[model samples]
Target chain A: MSISEAVVMNGGNGPYSYEQNSSYQKGVAAAAMDMIKEALPTTLDLYHLPLSSPNPIIRIADFGCSTGLTPIQAIETIVQCLLDLIKPIKEPRFRTLEFQAIFSDLPTNDFNTLFTNHLPVRRCYYAMAAPGSFHGRLLPTASLHFAYSSCALHWLSRVPQEILDKSSRAWNGERIYYVNSPAGVVGAYSAQFGRDMEMFLSARAEEMVSEGLIFMVVPGEPDLVHDSQTTLGSELELLGSCLVDMANEGIISKAKVESFNLPIYFPSEKELKQVISRNEFFHIERIQTLSHLKMHVAFPTPESRSLCLRVALEGLLCHHFGNELIIDDLFHRYSLKVAKSLFFLKPESHESISFSV
Target chain B: MSISEAVVMNGGNGPYSYEQNSSYQKGVAAAAMDMIKEALPTTLDLYHLPLSSPNPIIRIADFGCSTGLTPIQAIETIVQCLLDLIKPIKEPRFRTLEFQAIFSDLPTNDFNTLFTNHLPVRRCYYAMAAPGSFHGRLLPTASLHFAYSSCALHWLSRVPQEILDKSSRAWNGERIYYVNSPAGVVGAYSAQFGRDMEMFLSARAEEMVSEGLIFMVVPGEPDLVHDSQTTLGSELELLGSCLVDMANEGIISKAKVESFNLPIYFPSEKELKQVISRNEFFHIERIQTLSHLKMHVAFPTPESRSLCLRVALEGLLCHHFGNELIIDDLFHRYSLKVAKSLFFLKPESHESISFSV
Candidate 1:
């Protein structure tokens, strides 16, 4: 399947929906709000927005916004901050200026929930939903004033071709990720991330106005930490091991495990910085590393952790494996394993890297 | 129920969805396309649209667009006409202008089906979905350049209150619409349509630029035609009789039928002209009456007509009567009645009224 058709979070507000399981992303937005407020006046130059025009309309967009609850809080903060900043100005047109919030995601996104169920009752912006992939262009050229995204960029446009090819050295046999796989597998994932980032940055450059500001929160690994030492890496490895355990008993096939790799990569700050700097279209204002350990408070039990992971990955896993019973059995085994792996990885693996451009 | 929540059609591509049952609306749109193409150049002043601005973007909106199949065709024709008109002009900036299409409907609309399945594989405009009541402000002030709607304006914001008041002379105790009702009931329906159109026109005026163009295709009655002589009026009356038939047999209560009324009104050309003239924000360029009889080709059999009507009104009926079995039984009875109503209405009942402002 193409990347756009997959990679969708479970939709609607049911027990396993992305909406019900997205509290960690909400915490990520809350932690990043202070940086968003502090950086806007310096890097964004909010005072000179298009308040002088006759329409005086400002556009702010959130890309890869799944069902829009996470982006709603962040966008509300940005709009409220802008309104408060311009309150002291005597320009009547500044007071008349309005904001248009664009909530964008893949076309398969559940926009009915986004617009009807998640939008605030007393918000101060006109809401619109744009449905398309974010890896390429979605908006009009040079029409965006502010662009924001969170917990979305780690998803590669597609999994690496080399990891799926049996003849390649990067063939990830019996593994679903590059946790302790060969270096060639890691290199292939890193290369795919680089290419996707180039496309993402250039597309944003074309969509944003010359003086626009962008804020993003991405899953990332620290430069000195190994992949298997992070929380995300350890969890993925635990789940892959459980899949192999099932395959051994004929519950699933080994070839299925070898062929299905997660289309995700945790880039280091150094790697992300190098890509942004090479593009020459945007200057990285700051990269803040945040350990999102507080989010674990919402999922204290192993069952809760397993449920969150299931809600996030159940859609993709079902698409690959085509059996819900096997998935249920694997997650049950995986959660028990997660309960005992205290020495394998550090809690600092919950790091989220945020930046302004 | 609130107008924003209750005006929705049946969602998704199920057997009862509005998407599959709305071919008559498509025919209404196609019938209006010729007049749309002929009226644009002289009335709209399309050549001078923000072509020289740094970020040249033109926005077009469709209010009351259910799942956007009807507007997709109309919007494509409009964009192609604009592109062809600008091709002969020797200005480079005119070629740089882009179009943005906004599809507006009630909050409960099925936007997932709209943006995912109905959008063209290749189209010129960037598509966006706006969810809210069109009777109030939705877009930013003066942000719209063109506005369009077809077969949608006849829907009132809500059912008229006088029709539900027990003591009022206009109370429609046994009927669901003003067909063959008393003069007081007809007057009450007309007054409600006038008020709803006032709110609709003023909201568009605030959202549209001074030079923007507005086009609408509304279900309408000729001045000489009686309420019992039109297809829509006769069909609605037939359904109401079906409800009364069930109520007499104790299948449902009389109070439930007494309190229920369809939230719709079809105005005469004289009434529409008077309302538009009183708004003062827009000038009516022309009003052309069209008989959309070709839509019958798609619904030749009584069963086909029954299914189409069921898909269009099942949600509203189920909400009022609160039983799916009753709705199915009502439609079953009404379809047989429609097949026998040979002397009640003429084939000319299939009329649509279009106007440009």
Candidate 2:
């Protein structure tokens, strides 16, 4: 299945929902506000668009805004920046500029909860949601003004095809992610990440105005760090071990474990730069390491850490396994394993990168 | 609470979902196709709008699409008509006309299901959805090209305030609709319908361009038929009697029944005409009754008829009573009563009217 068909954050206003368990994401958005403001242009080029309505509108879309509490903060910041930019404009139409906030995610995403959580803001902006994968064209050509996404680019459009092929050398046999997989598996994951990002950027380039600014927050390691040394790597390793342990004990079929893998790939700063260089339409304005993110403070203990990951991964896991109880048990085991592992040491944690294009 | 908060069709693709139980609405759309084509302008006035884009987009919005299997058919028909209208134009910009189909409903509606069911069509048009009550402005002014709504106008913006007020003479005590209520109660519902329609039209006027057309399908009776004599009136009466029986058996509170009304009003043709005449921006191009609808063929038995009503009203009942079992029991009792009553005669059922404005 395509990642858009199967992956989403846990929905509803419950204990395990992304709405409740996104403190780390919320922290990232809050910390990234100053950078977002600094990167935005002083004057918005709204008049150049082909739109001829007397009342001009600036449409901003937030990609991967699951249940939308954290992403709303980022969206609000961007909207505020644009408002400040146009405050003293001499043109009457520019002074009366309207905005439309479009929250986009997979079609299966929990948009009802997103809209309900952000009801009052509907009066301020023409708030609506577009349902589709970000890796494809979702809006009209040159229809968008600003684009923002937070901590969502780590997801590949789909798992690499070779990793699932039984005959391929790149087939990931035991590992669920590319953390400690074979070198071929790592290559396949890296190649897929490049292709997915290219598709994503190409779609955004078509949908956005020429003068549009896109700020993306993603999880990546520094150039000096190895994939296995990052905190994200350790977490995936612990999760994979838990599944393998369950399979060895004959709880779930080992064949099932071998066939399944998460469709997430956290790139390093070097890898991100390489991918951006290949795309011709956009230039990197700035790529700053977010020093303000306190991952340890956001997720202090193993229990809280497990919850954050659980909310993010539950939909993907449940869709692959077709069992919610198995996911719950796996997360419980992974949390216990985290307590014993060196995960809390947070060795060179790598989930802080904000780049403007 | 507003109608948008409490009202939704049964969600999920289950036996009780609106997706499964909307055969009558589907047939009405299919039957109304001929009239829809005839009334549509032979040439679409797309160039008049102030869009200056190298590529132009024609946006169509379908309001009150519950779970969306039926409204999609109407949307596809309308898009096809516009495509035919623009096929002969020699202008290069007119040759590649793009469309954006926006599906609108209440915030609580199951938009995930709506998007998923129509996934393939997303490639044909940049299809998306907006969440809000259609009685208010949901799109930008002069942004929409074609507006279509089917079988959703009868739902008032909310239950009439006077009908719920204890101090008022119009307080509909123990009656769930205005079928045979007191004169004051009927007047309250009629007034609410008028105000809701006016607001709905005003919003559409602001959202549409000067040459834009809106086609709406609503349920109403002819001028000669009394409100109590119609099949819709008999159906509401049966549902109310079922609730009263449960109340007498100490199953639920009478006050609960008294405080509840359907927020649904089936206007007469004369009433619809009066409301349309009050709105200044729109002129009646054509108002045709859908004679091709085969209500008897669509739902031949009482069990099927009960199911159709259950799928439409279950969410509203569950929201008000705070229990799913009560709604099931109420509908079951109502079904048995329908089998024993004069419902099979079909007694001039009034639920088909299509008008272009």
- Model 1: how far residue B258 lies from native, Å: 1.6
lDDT of 1 by residue, B1-357 (tens): 454376677778877787877777677777777777887777767665543267677888989888847777878888887777767888666767888889998877889888777887567889898888888899998778889987778888888898889899988889988988877888888888889989999999999887888898888877767754454576688788988899999999998889888888888788889988888798888887864544456566666677777876776777677762377777788778877775223444454344333
Q: A38-57, model 1: which lDDT tens digit per residue?
A: 87777766656543276677
Looking at model 1 chain B, report the run of 10 residues with the lowest lDDT sum: B343-352
Question: Can you write out model 2's per-residue Cα lDDT over A217-289, one digit (the tens) per residue?
Answer: 8777666766545546668878888889988987788887888888888787778888988998877777777
Candidate no. 2 TM-score: 0.93
Tens-digit lDDT track of model 2 for B1-357: 455577778888899988888888887777666667877754346556544357688889988987757767777888888788777778788766688888888888888777777556345678777888898999987888888887889888889889888889987788888877777888888899999999999999998877888888887766676654554666887888888888888888888888878888878878898898999988777676766555556777778878988988887887776652387788888878877776456534534444333
Candidate 2 ranges with C-alpha deviation above 4 Å: A41-52, A165-169, A227-230, A323-325, A345-357, B41-52, B165-169, B227-230, B323-325, B345-357
Cα deviation of B208, candidate 2, in Å: 0.5
